[model samples]
Target chain A: MWDTIIINPFINLLLWIYMMVGNFGVAIILFTTLTRVILYPLTAKQIKGAQAMQELQKNKRYLDIQEKYKGDKEKLAQEQMKLYQELKINPLSSCLPTLLQFPIIIGLYQALIQSIASAPLDLLKLTRHLYPDFLKIPDLIPLNTQFLWMELGQPERLYIPGISFGIPILTIIVVITTYISSKVIAPPPQPGANDQGAMMTKMMNIYMPILMGWLSYTLSAGLALYFVVSNVIQILQYAITGKIYWGNVFPWLKKTEIKKP
Target chain B: MKNKILTIFIVISVLAISLTSCSDMNSTATSWGGATVTDSAVYFADGMQVIALRLDNGAEIWAYPEKAAANRTFLAAPVLVGEQLIIADAGNLLTSINSRDGVTQNWQFAGAKGKYIDSPLVVGETIVAQNADNSIYALDLKGTKLWAFTAEHSFWAQPASDGQLVFAPNFDHYLYAVNLETGVLRWKTELKASLVARPTLVDGVIYVGNLNGDFFAVDSERGTILWETKVAGGVWAAPIFVDGLLYFGDQTGIVNILDAADGSVVDSINVESGIVGSGVIVTDGIVFGKENGDIITIGFDGSNLGTKTVGGSIYSNLSINGNLFVVVATKGDNPLVAFDTDVKQSWVYTTSKK
Candidate 1:
């Protein structure tokens, strides 16, 4: 049960590959690349649909009809539907790929947690480790949750050597990374758009980064590692797709972008 | 418009196919040897009913609601000894119902104690019931109090005996060896880790692991530590001994084998998932449940023998009779399932069905 459900097949393959490569960061990068490749078709369809919706929004007559029928909910819906039909754009076509990625991402996160062997209570029959079992080293922190002064299993807390500050440094990094990732891909708001849809989009743009950052801090470092790698990969993907991958895109500007949200 | 209908049909067809494939992917794993050679029909709490199935033919003989009412719940497995079926209820009541008629013959534990016994281990004439209040109560076959021993913490591990002394590990990081007759603590050794499952005893060596992933081999009589090995993950399930090797599943999905004599690492296999409870050893084969609600069996050479997937987590030990295994399977999204070891559709029983 634990193996079949929590230890997802994708994570297993990636971990197996990680063991062979001896680098988790590299494993995450490769895994994300493969995931993006698998989702390419869906994303392409969504991008095309978004362009069509933008094209439809350019019609002033359709906008005027919507404004006039706004008081009548049924007439407004019919007019919107008619406009969508004329433009050949599906209203929700842009959401499918993003929605489909939710379960996969969740499964990936679960797999990483299970792989790190965290939360021993919820894990089943895993008394031994898949890796090397050190007999005399339990005295110095169980399993190496630390790498380069960062506790890989814990969110980065401010440590003063003699004091327990518990300040979440990793959370800050997560917030910054998520902000940068969203800024790189977020669609620009249309001119004279309805306030409700505009507000929703604005709220999502602001809140989603904070949510991801909070999750990065609260969850295991395996997930944090995933997020960090994912953000880097997304940035790289954007650069490549935008035809700007040949040279360094202002490193100074990238740092500023990280601080946006 | 035609495309819209086609899209809807495609969506519905995809959903139907996925659901059917998911159901069809249901398979069986290595199960406990649950079928007993005895004459009395065997029954364990599955979901809502106590399924009385023939041990010989694996046929359902009778099915009854496990509880008296829809709200009543039971925690312990229904133990069939002679003519009686001993079961523990939620209100800390131990009822010995007639096996043939399933009637109330004897009821013990008058008022509400902390919580009822999680599971009872019957050794000879004495039935050792571990209460949630960290006490082990010994009851005679007639439901009379014999003696009770209190541990430093709650006792989750089942008590095992060498036909003389009862060894039990508690949450207080100590394993106590008690005299079964007088309920006297012969010796207590601090393990530095909480024991969650019963220790596997082979020959005179007691092998037990802790929540800290430390496996120890202690001398049964002297209460002396022979050796200690640290696993990567904490062990929640009891270790099983087979062919001079000890096997234990931790909260992680790794299955480790250690030398029964010196606590040396023999071999390790990752089942790609964590196990939920201790495994049942049948000769060279081991069968256990995982937290993911799957039953897995492994052979002596670290080979995957079989697997059975269930809907709920497996919380009980597998009762082995012969080639057949019996377990309290919480199948589907529902709360109860009493099925054969083969994961066959025997009957669904719940504690709330009555």
Candidate 2:
């Protein structure tokens, strides 16, 4: 069922795109762009919602509720919901679209692994799930794996003599890009905001980059490329929507301002 | 609730990422493939699909999976035994396919631990295979287990034998000698490092190298290291002994020819790319593949005969029959490329072409 709904279609789409571009790296970029196009409306709406939420946090009533219920955790939660309802704000609007993109990311990761299959076995594994129509591409047995200086199918660690430092180039790029995107997309934590959800977001903001960096370091360069492209696109979407708060994304560069109530 | 679940997922993903040791993740497609060739056909384990192709023209006869198996992927070389092909996948399912037609399953067995990582070694009628978790199973032609061998670490290399006795290299830094008939440990010798390549039996001496780039020449009968020498890099492929001269490649892409008698380095030919696949000695000269997809052929004196780039990296062993020499470019656009003595591609078989 998953195969028909997600895996097979993704694998076939990737192969078809790969056939057109004759290179897996370009194919990945094109596929990422196509997905972004499909999800643009949802992504844009979410970005706008986040912007709204950031503005809402600056409201005097919201700040008063947060300060008044600072001691009662459950009361603070109820009051926050009550205030949001009074303001006609849907807090989930910003999250659903971000959640919607996860399956696509997982699906693309699987597709890229099989499409940029470096091993014959990996390629053979791909043959099992491919849509029958894709098999008709003529002389398309070996997809070109090279993209610039990287072998898209292999891990992207660079080796230099005598240095002994393992440099994962794509991993570093993925980390920086992911951090940049999170900064653009996430609503800035209010100065002295004592909230559970806000704390979790802060944790994600910090730890997520490290985790993503590790994945990009270990996984095939093809997947890393997809991640980099995905992050860049998300960043671009935020920039276009005018939702990016530079201070929030780059916290150290700007001092946190305590609002004058 | 949604936010809570999302936070949990983010935390789990971060944990998974931190635990990952920069190795191929469990989520990625597995990375094993090689082809074994006979006079009439070439068989490949493409991941989940096992394919049979005509050796002459790279035409496809049949492909397994006909549809995808949700939990299985064929990730290694399929051992061709007589009329049937005895193949095992990473799913712990050992299956036999009829080589003539490609779709018939004769029988199957499982190891109960994990999938087999190395190609099973075929003796007269016994098939011996090792798993990634360090268990070896010996089975008869009928898929019946005769005996099982266990070690401390994983065995990634195929077992080699001198008819009466078997030699297996383990990642636990030991080479074991087992009695093929009884399945008992005949003798065992610890090495300087983890031994991964199948031991090459020359005369009666067993030559093997480890991940530490330490190569050893062991006396097969007594199970003792006769001599050990350090090479340039890790030895991933099996060593090839041609006549009196010995040749093998390291992870650094340098092929070293050692004096088979004293384990002395006679000549070293650096291919400038990592050598992940073993070298094949053809009628023309000694030919091996580098991880960068170049097939390097050299003479006895280590002169650069020629180099040709096929595609991707080469990790599988080279299969040669007559003038048709084939190696599965297990990476990149995974294709089974056959070349003749003149270093020309005869035919290429991949999933798309067939």
Candidate maximizing lDDT:
2
Give a tens-digit lDDT track for model 2, residues B1-354: 467757666755854543343234442245657777787787888766778888788888888757757577776778888898987776678888788877778888875465566688898988888775567788899998998889876666788988788899876678889888778999999886666677788789998887657889999999988988889876877888887777888876789999888889999888898776677777668889877777888886788888887787776678777778887775567477888867788988766885
Between which residue pairs do clashes occur in model 2?
A118-B331, A118-B332, A119-B330, A119-B331, A120-B330, A121-B46, A121-B47, A124-B46, A125-B46, A125-B48
**lDDT per residue (tens digit) for residues A1-261 in model 2:** 766788788888887887887787888899888889889999877877776787787788888988898799899989989988888888988878877776676667767777654433454445456665555312343456779878776678776788788678889999999888886667567775537658667666777687778777777788888889988988887778766666675765445422312
**Winning candidate number (DockQ):** 2
Residue A111 in candidate 2, Cα distance off native in Å: 22
Interface Cα RMSD, each model: 11.9, 12.4
Instruction: Single out the weakest 10-residue window by summed lDDT for candidate 1 chain A.
Output: A134-143
Give the residue spans of candidate 1 off by over 4 A: A1-261, B1-39, B47-50, B56-71, B282-284, B306-312, B331-354
Candidate 2 global TM-score: 0.59
Per-prediction DockQ: 0.04, 0.11
